[model samples]
Target: MASCKFLFIYPDINEFSHAYDGNNGCYYYGIAQLSSVLKRVGVETGLLHYTLRPAKEKFLNDIDNFTPDIIGFSSTTMMIADVYEWVRWIRESGRHSPLVLGGSHATLDYKRVAADGLFDVIFIGESEESIVEYCQHYRERPTNILGTVVKGDNDYIFNPARVLEQNLDRYPFPDWTLFDYESLYDMKTHKRGILMAARGCPYRCSFCSNDRYADLYRNKGKILRIKTVDYVIREAKAMKIQYPAINYFQFVEDTVGFDRIWLKEFSERWPREVGMDFYANLNVNVCNDDTIKLLALAGCRRLQIGVETGNESRRKEILKKPVLNKTIEAVVKECHKHDIDVNSLNMIGLPFESEENILETIHFNARLKPKLLQCTIFYPFPHTSLYDYCVEHKLISESNLSRTDYFRESILENPKISQEALYFFRDNFKTLIKIYRYVNIDWLIRLVGYKRAGKIIRLFRTRSELKKWLYQPRKKLLKYV
Candidate 1:
């Protein structure tokens, strides 16, 4: 076959209103890795990183310019609406390239994606090997390929699932050159070198897709796979050398400290070789005292630990994160002792969670005294356990909910909690944290009650201009308290 042009569209949806520029400071591992694998097999690759909804003219112009044989889209559940819009444009423009859908949304909701009739083919789980075979025989109708859903006579074909790759290092380092890597680095405030040193998270957080993914490839191999310590150190060195201006490294894996032996070896070698300040995500359960010390010794200046909710019962039963409150407290305390800045991640507006529950999370953060705190409204993605719960309990319609950015608002129609209260806590979470530091916010909650407080805070949304006018004095009064 002659050389083929493969154009991949990454609907990197952040805020809907942002422009369709390529400078979105994100590197999707799936896209880059796929691109590299395709390139290795001598296929030409190009990318359209769209952050905004595209105008018809510009969207068609990009498609016409690239003139690809295969038009692949990488999508998440939240970004499916954007993908639908783009695919419609491609069809209306009379482009006959075979459309392929892949990524988290495709893997989790392959049946839905296949039934949509939007794409000619759908790739489900890890498709490195299957993708290469598909690319090699794109001109002919291919079937029975592992880890794909394809259209067939009479009905769609559900192919056998692919085994998860055991040795992650066998795959080429992601082709960052496909993306505007320099602009992504330059756009950042602190010039972070984003890298992923591992694949898979063993924990089955209810809201996360890891559990479902693990179940998909149940007997394939070990669920959690980490790169060799030497491989990671080499990749770090390569990134640092290529981008000399990188101030720090952020390992964007689920949890870099999953393997104690790998972490121990990494901790010893990283500071001596790469010698750059780094940050990583660690599961709260893994943030033991020895791990904290090792991380600090490796020049880790900060770590992000997900506390999800402060209510231990809810965390254990509802969220399926069995970490105790005592463990969380000890983790934060140990991080501080090692002079590592702790960034605590929390969520609000969960199903059946009340204003008091949100306040409990906020007060929990105050007690932990994390250097940074981030809270987002819970978004129930398709096929996750919580999503099924939301659907079955009538909190949200599984098929009818609109696309949502979790940071913006929840799609759940929960009776126990109002969106107003959720918006209030989300908008003023930091302010409430500050106020809690000075005085007891619970006193005001007690005086007015949760419902009344929620009603009062709704003014910030109802009268947008009055929000600023009222916010300053409220904070000032709290300062006096």
Candidate 2:
């Protein structure tokens, strides 16, 4: 019998996930999840990073010691150049290990990355099946693999895409033992382990890369899939037993409450079983009063939803979220009614985004009075509607891979909206949100919540009574596209 070592690299880039970059200090414990997944398939995995200024020689030594047959990496779009450095280093080692690149960047631009020959394969979609299959087969047949692009004999045959829209429960519970949890958590503001219950999102907001996962599973389009309730609960319980002291359960489900049955069942069973606070992106289309009721009961502490814009035109035209303005009104009101702690995601700098659009988003968000409001500058990522639009319209001067993050504004020329205008939009609206949260919103809080439940108490007799709040003539968000 022969054995192979696989090194899954979460390259020690300066930035973390979408939320942990720049000003906000956050910890990433995803290595634990990734490692657990690998272990499920009978593979030994280790992480390689030079985070603490570890010498280049020390890094080289570790790579030599591992002597891996395959090296897999996960990265954000902006971190591709950073990946290049690591790839260069690995290549320099002269071992020529088969490199496997996954994560958002590679998922979005697998062909370009594979064509460069930096990696032996690019795992296109959700990696559980494809990756595990590839690793096991690599022990026998390394080249001709499924669900990825490999360095085939005479041509680069990118395998027809497939989305691994499978039962999440089938995979092994993430091995939390693999992470430097305390070391990583000690340096951050928010600390807790995260688990994924489902894969893919059905919605197609223009600014979002939601389909990235489905793109990997199959070349054809499809909606999201969830891990079964029993499977999800089993993992949740197993993780609780494993972590013991973990108080927060963070789920990376693109939209957590998409199904009312799962939400209600999880909510009902969570407290008695896992008893942890959780945070996830909840889709407005799926959530209603009953869903919020279940979530609150289930020990969910935070619900993050996007109110990308308030402008009717922007919401439908630019944002491409089927959410009607009225639906947004109902969703926010319902969340507040249930007293669910809420965070609203807002973005500025869509190519044609104007000050009027910004104002509309702000005015609309003000109605919900979310516990936290984040305003992010948009970065055009590969394979999204927004990215195509920007490229086609020649919205920016040049597209530099370096500017895929918040570090720089649009590098493209002829940007429909100026960088100055984007920041101005953020500044004008964000300040109001800051001030509202910091000082004068106590009265508003009472209106949205109820007592004895530690949740949102309804201010009106029924949702219909809140009609005034949703459709007030004076308060209507009249901001523009």
The top-ranked prediction according to lDDT is 1
lDDT per residue as tens, model 1, 105-184: 99888988888888888998888898788989988879778889988876789987887888998888778789887766
**Against the unseen true structure, what C-alpha lDDT does each candidate score?**
0.81, 0.65
Candidate 1 wrong stretches, greater than 4 Å:
15-25, 185-187, 442-481
TM-score of each: 0.91, 0.81
Task: For candidate 2, write residues 319-340 as lDDT tens digits.
Answer: 6887776876787677677677
Off by over 4 Å in 2: 12-34, 49-58, 139-141, 163-165, 186-188, 212-222, 397-399, 412-416, 427-429, 434-481
- Quality of model 1 by C-alpha lDDT: 0.81
Q: Model 2: how far is 203 from its true place, Å?
A: 1.0
Distance from true position, residue 130, model 1, in Å? Answer: 1.7
Which residue window of length 10 is worst by lDDT in model 2? 449-458
TM-score of candidate 2 versus the correct structure, residues matched by position: 0.81
